[model samples]
Each structure stands twice: as C-alpha cells, then as structure tokens.
Target: MTVILNQSFTGISIGAVLLLIALGLTLTFGQMGVINMAHGEFIMAGAYTTYVLQKSISSAGISLLVALPLAFLVAGAMGALLEWLLIRRLYTRPLDTLLVTWGVSLMLQQLARDVFGAPNVQTHAPDLLTGNMSVAGVTLANNRLFILGLALLCALTLTLILRLTPLGRRIRAVVQNRDLAEVSGIATERVDRTTFFIGSGLAGVAGVALTLVGPIGPTMGTNYIVDAFLVVVVGGVAQLKGSVITAFALGVLQSVLEYSTTVSVAKVIVLVAIVAFLQWRPQGLYTLRTRSLV
Candidate 1:
C-alpha cells in the first residue's frame, strides 16, 4: 500500500509537469491551429530566465518568485513577436507554419548553445523546496509539491481567464468563427497576438517549474515537446478539460508502468495505448464545437 501510494504521488507530480507544458500548447496549436514547433524554445527561454535571475539575485526564493512573472513576459513577448513577424502570414498554411517554426526552433537552439554553451545547467532549489515530507508513509518531495500546486493554480487561473474575462470571450469568439468575430467588430488580429502571448507565456511558467525537477539545457525543451503535444492531442484540441484529465491519466499510467518495467518500455507501452485509443476515437477525449463553415 505504501509503495502504491508513493508511485501514485510520483505519477501526480509528473502529471503536473505535463499539464504545465501542455496548457500553453492547448491554446497555440490546439485553439489557433498552428503547429508551433518553436513553442519549446519559449519554455527554454523561461528556464534560462530563471537561471539568469538566480545568478544576479542574492536570494534563490526571491529570484524564483521574480522569474515566474518575468519569464512569462520574456517568453510571451517572444511569442507575440513571432506571431507578428511570421505566423500571422501563415495562419491558413499549417504545414508552412510547421516547417517555418521547426527552422526557428533550430535557430533558437543554436543561439542558446552559443550563449550558454553545449553543457547543461542546473539551478539550486530554494531551501524551502529542497526537503521532503512524509504523509501517511508516502514521501513527497517539496519541489514536486510546489510544482503540483503551481500547475493547479495556473490551470485554474487560465480557466477563469477563458471562461469569465472579456479577452477570453473575444478569444472564444474568434476561435468559433474568425470571419464572424471580425464582422462583429472584434479585432481578430490583435486577439490572435494576445492569445499567442498567453499561450507562450504559459510555456514560460512551465519552464520555471521544471527547473526544480530537472536540468536545464538548450535541448531540454526538445525532450518534452513531443510528450506535451501528445497530452494536448490526446486531450482534444481546444479542450481545456480534456487536457487536464488526459495529463493526469497518462502520468499515472506511465508511472505505474515504469515501476513494473523499464522507463523505455513504459514509454512505449504508453504510446501504444495512446495510439490504440486514438484509433478508436480520433477526435480525442473531447471535440471543440466551432461555428466556422469550413
């Protein structure tokens, strides 16, 4: 029972990380219908932002707190800039966006390599997050708990923004029917830019949380990009509820499988399961209802 509980907690923690990474993609790739291969670079930018702040700031905790918002701005600005410069021109051409973003991702990776070098970097967790606590014989790492709470908080905040805010209403309107939304006097283009900013900003926040659990490097974003996409796709594009449920489900499944088999095997099993599930329901766990004629 103790072992089971521990593995479950571990799985939940992993799910939290996945949720953070995929939440942004849910908006960009899922809602906007753009295959943004460079999304991971935004995450890298955030992680690096945390790294830079830690170096300059005297307090690790303070730097981390500052990194949360600053990283969002940094990454969000990059996303907004990318959308303005290139993505705006290629919205209807998803393949072009994919190829273009892939190239951009490579460029960003090289830039990071040049600036930070090829070696991976590690950040020191604040004293508050470096310890562990036991609850009912299940040991919980403080950093992981922090990550879990952060992920939930982000998800909740995003939910409220989408469901209640004026900006979110415009976003939803544009998403449901772009032409109609424009006809209704909504600034669809501006909405697109703002949406991209928020989506990419979430990726930045994910990066900051990740530094607590893993190493940071130029290629680190690549390691999780596929998985993040998987979570979004499996959950259903533009379906926030689906993403939340799918992230935790896959996380727990992967954790349990890894316990019984090898990490590689566990991943393969999870992939196979996802593939089978998709074959049965290709629309994913949920489907977006849109008013667009096309």
Candidate 2:
C-alpha cells in the first residue's frame, strides 16, 4: 500500500505533464481542424528555451518564474509561424496537413540536432523549486509538486479565458461555425492564429515542465506527441475539462500497472483500453455542442 501511494503520486506528476501537452493538442485539433504532426516541435523549442534561461539565471542570473511564460511565448511563436507558413495551407486538407507537419517535425528535429547535438540537454531546477515533501507516508519531489501546481493553474487560466473573455466567445463561435462567425464580423483568421499560439505555447510549457523530471533533447517531443494525441482523442476534442480527467486517469492507471509490471506492458494495456473505449463511444468521453467542423 505504501508503495502504491508513492507510485500514484509519481503517476500524478507524470499526468500533470501529459495534461499540459494534451490540453494544447486538443484545442488546436478541435479549433483549427488541422492535424499538425509538428506540434511536438514547439515542445522542443520550449525545452531549448528553458535550457538557455537556466544558463542565464544560474546562481542568481536567471528567473525560473519568468522562464515559465517566456517558454510559452517562444513555443507559441514557433507554433504561430508554422501555422502561417505550413499549417494554414494544409487546413483544407488534413491528410496533407499531416504530411507537411511531419516534414516540419523532421526539419525541426534535425535543426535541433545540428544546434544542440544528438546528446540530451540537461535543465537544472530553480533553487526554490528543489526539495522534497512527504505526505501521508508518501514522499513527493518538490519539483513535481511545483509542476503539478503550475499545470493546474495553466488549465484554470485557460478555462477562464475560454469562458469569460470576448476573445473566448469569438473562439467558440469560430469553432462552432466559421462561416457564421465571419458573417458576424468575427475575424476567424485572427482567432485561428491566436489558437495556434495558445496551443503551441501550452506544449512548450509542458516541455519546460518535463525538464523538471527527465532528459530534454531534440527528439524528446516525439515520445510525448503520441501520448498527447491519445489523451486528446480519448477525452474528446474541444472539451478541456474532459482532457484533464482522462489524462490524469490514464496517468495513474499506467503508473499503477507499471509498478506491478513492465512499463512497456503497462503502456500497451493502456493503449488497448483507450482503443476499446473509443470504439464503444467513438465520440469520446465528452462531445462538443453541434459543430459543423468536428
């Protein structure tokens, strides 16, 4: 039982990272209706950004606090750029979007390899974020706790933006009916760009959060992209709340199973289960209101 508690906490930590990644992917897929294979590249971009920030702020030289949002901006800009150049063209053809985005992913990966090398890059935890905490006989890493808090905060902030802001109304309008939104004088083109920015930025923030736990590298995002897609798909696109629940549930499920078995086997079981669940529902755990695009 003690072992289970410890493992569960660890799993929650992992889930937090996945939540961040999946949330972004879900929004982009649901809103833009584009399947971007290169979404992971922004994550790598965020990782590199964190690495640079670490170099600057080491020993009172940098600010991890500031890096959080900066990393998002860095990744968001990359995402927006990709949308402007490659993604926009492929919007009408999702299959082609996949092809173009995949090529972009390759180019981004190779570019990182050229600049950062093939070896994994390391990021140091901010002094304030380094430590450990024990609760209910379970020891939890402070860094993980910090990340979890940050993840929840990001989700809440986004929820508020989507629910309360004028921009949010426009975003929802566009997602529901692009023609209708434009008819009402809503510049869906701008909304699309902002959506790309938010989605990419979230993934980048996830990359930064991930560096707190493990290795960072050019191909690192590849490992996460598939899982992110899984969470988005399982939770149902356009439903941020559903994404959170599914991500954490999957995370805890995978962790408990891994503790009892092999990680690979745990993953296989989880994937199969997700596939079965989707087969039954097809729409996901949550469905969006009537929308022409979805």
Candidate 3:
C-alpha cells in the first residue's frame, strides 16, 4: 500500500510535467494549425537557460527562482522570432512546417552541443528542494512536490488568462474563426504571436521541472516530446482541461505499468492502448465546437 501510494504521487509529479508540455503543444497547434516539430528544442533551450543562470548566480535558490521568468522570456522570444522569421511563412502549409521545424530542431540540437558540449549537464536543485519529506511512512521528494505545485500554479494562471483577459478573448476569437475575428476588429496576427509566445514559454517551464527528475542533455526534450504529444492528442486538440486530465491518467497508468513490467514493455502496452482508444474515439476525450474555416 505504501509503495502504491508513493508511485501514485510520483505519477502525479510526472503528469504535471506532461501537462505543462502538452499545454504548449496543444495551444500552438490549435491556434496556428502549425505542427511545430522543433517545439522540443524550445524545451531544451529553457533547460540550458536554467543551467546557465545557475552557473552565473551565486545562490542556487535565487537562480532557480530567476530562471522561471528568464526561461519564459528566452524561450518566448525565440518562439516569437521563429514565428516571424520561419513559421509565419509556413502557416498555410503544415507539412512544410513539419519539415522546416524538424530541420530547425536539428540545428538547435547541434547549436546546443556546440555551445554547451555534447555531454549531459544538470543544474543543482535548490537546497530547499534537495531533500525528501516523510509523512506516515511515505516519502516525497521536495523537488517533485515543488514541480507539482508549479504545474498547478501555471495551469491556474493560464485558465485565468483564457477566462478573464481581453487578450484571451481575442485568442479564442481567432481560434474559433480567424476571418470573423479579423472582421470583428481583433488583430488575429497579434493573437497568434501571443499564443505562440505563451505556449513556448510553458514548454520552457516543463523543461525546468524535468531537470528535477533526471539528467539534462541536448536531446532531453525528445524524451518527453512523444509523451507530450500523446497527452495533447488523447485529451483533444485545443482543450486545456482535457490535456490536464489525460496527462494525469496517462502518467498514473504508465507508472503502474512500469511498476509491474519492464519500461519498454510498459511503453509498448501504453501505446497500444492509446491506439485502440483513438480508434474507438477518433475525436479524443473532448473537442472544440468551432466554426469550420472555409
């Protein structure tokens, strides 16, 4: 029972990271109709940013705190720049976007290797997050708990933006109907840029959270990219609530399966299950009822 409980908590921690990644992916795809294959590189960029900040700052804790906003700014600026320089031209051609972004991904990977070396590097977790807390014979890592909280906080902030802000209204307007949104005096182009910025920023946060779990390498983002996409797909495109629920569901299921079987086998089983589920419900867990773009 204790083991099960521990695994459940661990699963939730993993789910939080998945949710963060998926939120970014879903928003970008849903808003722009662009398949950003290089999204994973943005995650890598954020992790590297955290590493650099940690090295430059005297206090690890302050660096960690500073990294969040700095990572957002760094990744968000890169995302916006990519959108302007490359992605903007490929919006009407998703296949081209895929190919272009994949190439971009490779370039970013090589850039990281060239700049940071090909070896894996990790920033130390803040002292406050280095130890574990035990309660009732169950132990929880401080870092994981902090990540879980961070994820929830991020989700809440996003929810508020989408629900309460005028910019969010413009975003939803564009998502629902680009032409109508433009005709209604909303700057669809600006909304698209903002969506990309926020989405990429969230991916950066996920990368920060990921460092708590394992080593940071040039390709660390690749490790979770597939799972992140699965979370987005299983939840439903453009559906944040669906992403959150599916992330937790997939995380817990994967954790339990890994506990029972080998990691490879567990992954295969999970993929098969997702495939079957998709076959049954091709639209996924939820769908946005938006007017068809003519």
lDDT of each: 0.91, 0.86, 0.86
Per-structure clash totals for the candidates? 0, 2, 0
**Candidate 2 lDDT, tens digit per residue, 107-181?**
999999999899997877876677788788899898899889988999999889999999888888887778889
lDDT of model 2, residue 126: 71
Off by over 4 Å in 2: 291-294
* Residue 238 CA displacement from its true place in model 1, Å: 3.2
RMSD of each: 1.3, 1.7, 1.5
Tens digit of per-residue lDDT, candidate 1, span 152-230: 9999998899999999999878866778899999999999999899999998999999899998999888988999889
Which pairs clash (backbone N, Cα, C closer than 3 Å) in model 3? none
Which run of 10 residues does model 2 get worst, by summed lDDT?
58-67
TM-scores of the candidates are 0.97, 0.95, 0.96
15-53: candidate 3 lDDT, tens digit per residue = 988888888888888787787877898999889988999
Residue 5 alpha-carbon offset, candidate 1, angstroms: 1.3
